[model samples]
Target chain A: MGGSTVEPVVRESVGSAPGNLAIASLARTLRCVECGHETRLEVHQSCPACLGPLAVTYDLSTLRGSVPSDRLSGRPRSIGRFAELLPPLSLPWSARLDLETTPLRPAPRLAEWLGVETVWLKDDTVLPTGSFKDRPASVAVAFAAAQGHRAVGCASTGNLAAATARAAVRASLPCFVFVPAGLPDSKLDPVRQFGGQIVEVEGPYDVANRVANLAAEAAGIGVVNITLRPYYTEGSKTLALETFEALGWNPPDAIALPLGSGALLAATERAISQLREIGWIPSGPGPALLGSQPDGCAPIADAFDAGSDEIVPVEHPRTIAESLAIGDPGSGYEALRAIRASRGAADSPTSEEVIAAIRALARTEGIWVEPAAGTVIATLRRLREAGTVRRQDRVVAFLTGAGWKISHAVALSRVGSAPIHLDPVHPDLSQLHVGPRPEALGGAE
Target chain B: MTTLVLASVLRQSAPSLHQKEYDGFRGSLLEFLNTVSAEGGPSFRGRIFDGDRLRRYLNVFVDGTDVRYLSGLATPITPTSRVDLIPAVAGG
Candidate 1:
């Protein structure tokens, strides 16, 4: 039940500033990842001069005195409340929900199952959009709105579509999210409900992604992950920040992250190093950063296993985990470097193992996750045997999204877990003869 | 043959890994960029790369190692090498 925030019962309303003045994010310059060229920070994509991904660096000395203030703790739980270390933007602090604080609960049962001493679940599933995309989408939309952008859009697998739309709606901007036509209605319907227009492409998620980039280039649309990426990707550090705060500033021994483009795992590494530099956490042995993926599209994992420095493009990634099904990941190199530096290991669990892990988390911990997060659980299970994770280490598994988003593909897939036809007289509890669920318990050992 | 595996962003204009071939090609990676740009690939004319070094967002890998880690665009390639051209963009 321990979370990141401790606020007063009654809070003062957040006031609005006169005229939408674009406030400077404490992050002043973005250093090009490849060329090391620095540029003035705003809503930026790749570096203008070098075209390499720009890395946002902040002066931690400025925040050391301001971050631990008593006034911040008394306010409600939101990402804006901890804006001292984040990118500069005038968020509607008046709104109750903007990257609200998520739970980092200790899972005793899960610890016993994984054989770790203290296993924690950083559940990002309870956001307004039912996914972790809320973190980046909230920041990107706010940054775009503050910069006087008339509209916003993004290319998404599904989770971000709804998240960007919801964030855009909060800022009173029309949202356009392009996704593959194959995405389920459970994912697409929410975007419509949140007033986001969906442009369904007639191909897989990869092709749809290309069209979105082209749109971002031609129409000058503020694509959350494309055009506004410097700020958008930086939003993931909040996850690491929240986790550290939840544990009372004690860093865990290991963290298992669900791998996609490999940005989240790399971002976790950046957060760990930043916190260390500012003396928030002690220096020495940092947490072993572990990354997991389904075998269907495990480019980073496969590359790490083969000890290859370059990421081979996965042109047609096939997987039940729609979120992690990126064939050609943009940050594959960064994630691979972080994992290697931490002396950590990466692995891919088969789709069956991923499904079993999903059911195991639900059965044991009452947490239903899609295959994306399930890869972490399944990978940790394997790591327990390989000594990448040990019984003495305190582990944190990041549950990135909720199960309802993929319930159609998972819940009703089998007959045993489905609803049984019952007659009126069969209402008695004795009529239900449910035995052991081998499906869920397949990978428990 | 040096097969250049372009990223999704570059694949928008150029071809993917298997779609094309660069058999028995002899040139530096910069010339390859100009050739691709001439064919409507990412324009490296003082924007992405110059005569000698790559400029901003694009990364080139000879075989499976980054050219920056190897020898920049001057990294030699074999007839059967696979080079990857990736942008600095991160996908979801």
Candidate 2:
């Protein structure tokens, strides 16, 4: 639980720099979810009271119409496009990592297959680091650099490791990533390529996370998911923001997201709530938030099904959806609250179902996502079948990571038309297999 | 006497701190925390409470369940109750 080049930073600024927003301008402050205590913008903090998590709140009380005030007219189409509603950031030009806007594509084929009226795929596979983690990493790294922290780091399974490391490298700060020992080199190499000093903690991801927290706190390094989470997580709300904007400011009937720490789903809920309050989105009954998880590691889904608020942590998660293998999701409570608030439900899909959905998406929508997103597609099927998500409902499923991240898992499973190694010298039509497409993408071609 | 335990980074506030016996202690968990805060030191005290509210980062578990699920700080604790003051640790 340690690193090199530690330094102390000090911001003694007190609660909410208010009144600046009451003038009908954009003013922001950090507020405690457990206790409504407001605090001024600073680095390395949580709610001073109750030890609950803190989140940024914007005073959109006087704001009207659309979200980002025409100020983004000439800006690059990145996360920064909607910076008005976000906390003020100062990412130096030399150390900038622009988070490009991912596609919210029409998935007519998927919609037809699911028997739904419309299906929109919010594909984040094209994002930096090939995952949605880059959105938060960019903000967290920038926030830390602005706050004068000497270094940045995070405890990650794989995605966040690369995301945080790349962002850190861009910020020119020394980066440390704590990951469980024994992860494949294919995963660790991505983070290492960014020059992130990888610290292989000899334990599970949870243990590595704890060690990272202790080490980051000691080294004065802003651990993206720990000390810098308020700002870090704020960056993810844009997932909803971007989608809603892409949909012409119209909220969908329902949205499904892969749930792990449950942070992304919770953040989407936050974005929806904010937009609704500001009258940007028509108030009554916004999109239902569907949380998806792998069956082997679905504490949030389990709690939702049992009609309980308690998240019985999955002590030993066993799932091919490695990114979704968070046994003790910190945001489980928050995600559940969102699901219930929207009258949505949480569900898990088996590894087999997940794999099937992945191939289905690939063959149908031409999108290949990691197993985490596959679980969401699988859950969408269940929800549609159970009448939870009606046939006529417009559904948007989040495909957050690239398929290559878990291509190894897919390779192990019985996937797509068998590989036909043809003898080039005497290649025959029999050797070449271009048979009719399977009814479902997973079965024999 | 109730057993009060502080966990994670919060334990740094009082290094010698461990299971404390609270005998004949009255009032809410917040009130008891006021006493614990005084013992932990002023800086630690400020981090744990903001007047009547517990800081957002700390979770007080009574008998192994988070007080947030209970009646919050008002969740009653008898002399035999076991209270755990655990900091909110991030996952992922």
- Compute each candidate's TM-score over C-alphas: 0.80, 0.81
**DockQ of candidate 1?**
0.27
**Model 2 chain A: which ten-residue window has the lowest total lDDT?**
A16-25
Candidate 2 on B5-31: residue-level lDDT in tens?
Answer: 765446656765558788888677877
> Candidate 2: TM-score?
0.81
Mind giving the per-residue lDDT tens digits that candidate 2 earns over A1-445? 1112211111232223211111111437888776788888776345655456678888765444434434234444677666656666653521275577899999888887788988999889998788999988887887888788899999888889999999888788999998888776667788878899999987567667766766775687788988788888888888888999889778899999999888888889988988777666788885999999999999999999999867777756788888888876867778889899998989999989898888889988888888999999999998898889898898999888988876577785555556777677976657665688757643211
Candidate 2's DockQ is: 0.27
How do the residues A1-445 of candidate 1 rate in per-residue lDDT, one tens digit apiece? 1223323223233444321222234576888766788877776677665566777888765444233434255444666655645676664622423666899877877777777777899999898888898988887787788788888998888999999999888888899999988798889889999999999987666667666765775677788888788788778888998898888778898899988888788788888888777666778886889999889899899999999986776656788888998776767777888999888889999888888788778878899887898889999989997887888989999999898898665853343565666678756676678687655443332
Stretches off by above 4 angstroms in model 1 are A1-25, A65-72, A91-97, A412-415, A418-420, A425-429, A433-445, B1-88
> Which pairs clash in the backbone of model 1?
A25-A88, A50-B55, A50-B56, A50-B57, A51-B56, A51-B57, A52-B56, A52-B57, B1-B79
Candidate 1 lDDT at A346 equals: 95
